[model samples]
Target: MPIMFGRTIKRPPWRQCKVGSRDDLQVGQALNNKVMELQEQDFNFTIDTAFTKEIRVERLPKGFKMPTIEQYGGTIDPEAHLESFKFVMLFRGASRRHHVPSIPLYLEGLAKSTEWFECLKPRSVSSFVQLGRAFIANFMSSRVDRKIMANLLAIRQRSNETLRAFLTRLNSEALKVWDLDPIVKFQALRSGIRDVELKKSMIMDEPADMHNLFSRCEKHINLVEVLAAKQEKEREPEKKN
Candidate 1:
C-alpha cells in the first residue's frame, strides 16, 4: 500500500503479480487448448461443407437395383471402361448429373484418375460427355494393340474353316477397324474366301455392295452345309457295313 494525497491506496493485483507463476502457466495452457479446439472445429466444418457441395446425391427409383461395374485400375483401356460405365448408368436410368459426379466412385488404384478428379476445380465438368472426353485423353496410352485398317485387310479364311465361320471372323475383324470404307471391306471379304467355286462366283458376279456380297456368301454357306450333311450320311452306311 502507498499513501497518495494523504489517502491510502492499494496497489493493483496485476502490478504485484510475478512471471512464471503456476496459475499463469495453467491459464496459458487453457488458452492454447481452446484455440486448438476452435481450429479443429473450423477444419471439420470446411471439410463437411466442401464434401456436401461437391457431391450431389440423387434418389434412385424404388426397388431398382444398381448394376455393378468393374473398377478401372488405369492399366486397361480407358475408353472401354468409360463405355461400360455409361452403359450401366443408362441401364439404371441415371441422368447426366449422376454421371458427372459418380465417376470418382468407380475409379480405383489410379492416381491419374482419382487424384486428377480431386484436384479439378468446382463446376469444371459440366456433363458426362465432357467427362468422358477428358478421361480418354488422360488414359489413352494404356490401350494395347489397337486394330488398324491393315489388320482387317490381312484377315484370311483358313483351309479347313467353314464358310459361316470364315464370314463370322471377317465380320468381327471389320468391326474392330476404325473408320473403314465400305468398298474396302467388300473387296477384303471377296479376296479372303477359301472355297474355289465361291471365289469364282464372287469374281464373276461382282456384287454391287456389301449386302449383295453377303447374300451371295449365304447361298454358298447353305450349299456347303447341305453337302457336309450328305457326306456324313454316306459315311454312316460304310460304318454299318
Candidate 2:
C-alpha cells in the first residue's frame, strides 16, 4: 500500500521556448495562461487589418440593452421626469453600459416619449456627452430650485386633497428646497396640514418643537391614509355589483 501511494505534481512550462532571459519564461507563461482564460470567457481575438500579422487584444462582451421610452413615460412633470432620468442612469451604471452609445440611446428614448425634449433630439446632437449636457440645460431647469423654495414657503393644503396627499407633496418639494430655516419650514409645513382634529390635538399637547410635532403627526396621517385606502378598496367590489 505504501509503495502504491503517490502525490500529483504541477509544473510550469519551461522547455517550450528559448528562454533567453530568466524573466522571459515567467512572462510568457503568464501571457499564455491569461490568453487561455480570455478564450474560456469567450473574448474575441481579431487580426489587426492595418497590420495583417498583429493580433488584437480580446474584446469585452457588450451586455447593455437599451431601454424603451414606453417603459417610462414623458417629461410632463419636471420632478417626475428627473426621477425617471436618474433611474435610467442608475440602470445603465449597473449594466456597465459605455457612455458613448448610452447618450444617444437616452436621447432616442426621450424623443420617443415626447417632442418636448427637442434640444435632446438625436438629429441635433453630434457628440454624445454634449447631448447629455444640453438635456440637463433644457429639462432640468436651474430655476427649479428657486421655484421649489418659493413653493415650500407658500404651500397650503388644498381643500379637495387628503392630508396624506398634501403632506406627501410638501415633503417631496421640501427635500429639494435647500437651506430653509428649520423653524420657518416647520411652521409652513404645519400650516399646510389640513387635518383639523390632528392640529387641535397638537395644539393641546404643545410639543417642544417641529421634530416632535412631525413624529406625532406622521403616525396619525399614515393611519388615516391606510384606513381611507382600505375603505376605498372595499367599496370598489360593491360598485362592481
Candidate 3:
C-alpha cells in the first residue's frame, strides 16, 4: 500500500512480480508485459490535498428549485434569448464560473447542434460575456429588423389608443434605436400626437427637453382619464332610465 493524500492506494500486482535468473531477452519481455498490464489497469484517486483545499465549491440552498429557461434555437432573436438567460441567472445568484458552462444546457435544435459549435472554442470563449457576443454574432441575421431613427419618426398615435398607451409604445420603440439624438426624440414625440388640442399646445410652446415634454404629457393623460370617467358617470343615469 502507498499512502497518498492521507488515503491508501493499493499497489498493483505487477509490483510484486520477481525476476529469477532469466536470460536478458526473457527479462526484457517479462518487464514489457508488466508495463503493459500497469497501463491497462484503472487507478481511481482523488485530487491532491493542496488543490482540494484551495478551491471551494458553491452549493445551491437545500430544497432550492431551478427555474426552467426557454430553449434558444437559431431561428429566434438571439439577443432576447440571451437577455432572458442572464435575467434568470442573476435571479438565481449564479457565479461567473457557473455562467459559461451552464448556458449550453439550455440550448437546443440548431442553436445547440450548429451555432454552439461555431461560437464556443477552447481558446475563444473563456467567459459568459464572450459566449453571448459570439452567440449573437452567429445568429444576428435571425433577429427582427433593427429599429432606426426613421422608425421612431414614423410612430403615430392610433385613433383608439390612449395617450398613455401611445407614449408607452413610443418609449419602447425609442429604446431599440441606439445612440438616439434628443432632438430626434423630441420631434418624434411631437409628431406622434393625434389629439388636436395636445398637438396645438405642443407646437405653440415646444418642450425645453424630454423632462418638460413628459411632464406636459402626464398632465394631459391624467386630465383625459378624469374627463372620460366623468362622461361615463353622466351616461349611467341615461342608461338606467
Best by TM-score: 1
Q: Could you tell me the lDDT of residue 34 within candidate 1? A: 82
RMSD of each: 13.3, 18.4, 11.7
State the lDDT at 201 in candidate 1. Answer: 88
Regarding TM-score, does 1 or 2 come out ahead? 1
Which candidate order results from sorting by lDDT in descending order?
3, 1, 2
| lDDT agreement with native, every candidate | 0.72, 0.55, 0.73
Query: What is the Cα-based lDDT of residue 190 in candidate 2?
Result: 65
Candidate 1: tens digits of C-alpha lDDT, residues 63-160: 76667889888888887888788889888888766676677677777533344454344345556776777777777888655687778778888888
Model 2, 168-195: lDDT tens digits are 7877777766566676677677667778
TM-score of 2: 0.37
Best by lDDT: 3
Instruction: Give me the runs in candidate 3 sitting further than 4 Å from their true place.
Output: 1-65, 118-120, 154-172, 178-187, 194-196, 200-241
lDDT of 1: 0.72
TM-score, cand. 1 vs. native: 0.54
Where model 2 places Cα greater than 4 Å from the true spot, the runs are 1-62, 65-83, 91-97, 107-130, 136-146, 157-187, 191-215, 218-241
Task: For candidate 3, write residues 136-222 as lDDT tens digits.
Answer: 888899987679999999999999998999999999999888689989988898889898998899889988889999999999999
Backbone clashes in model 3, listed as residue pairs: none
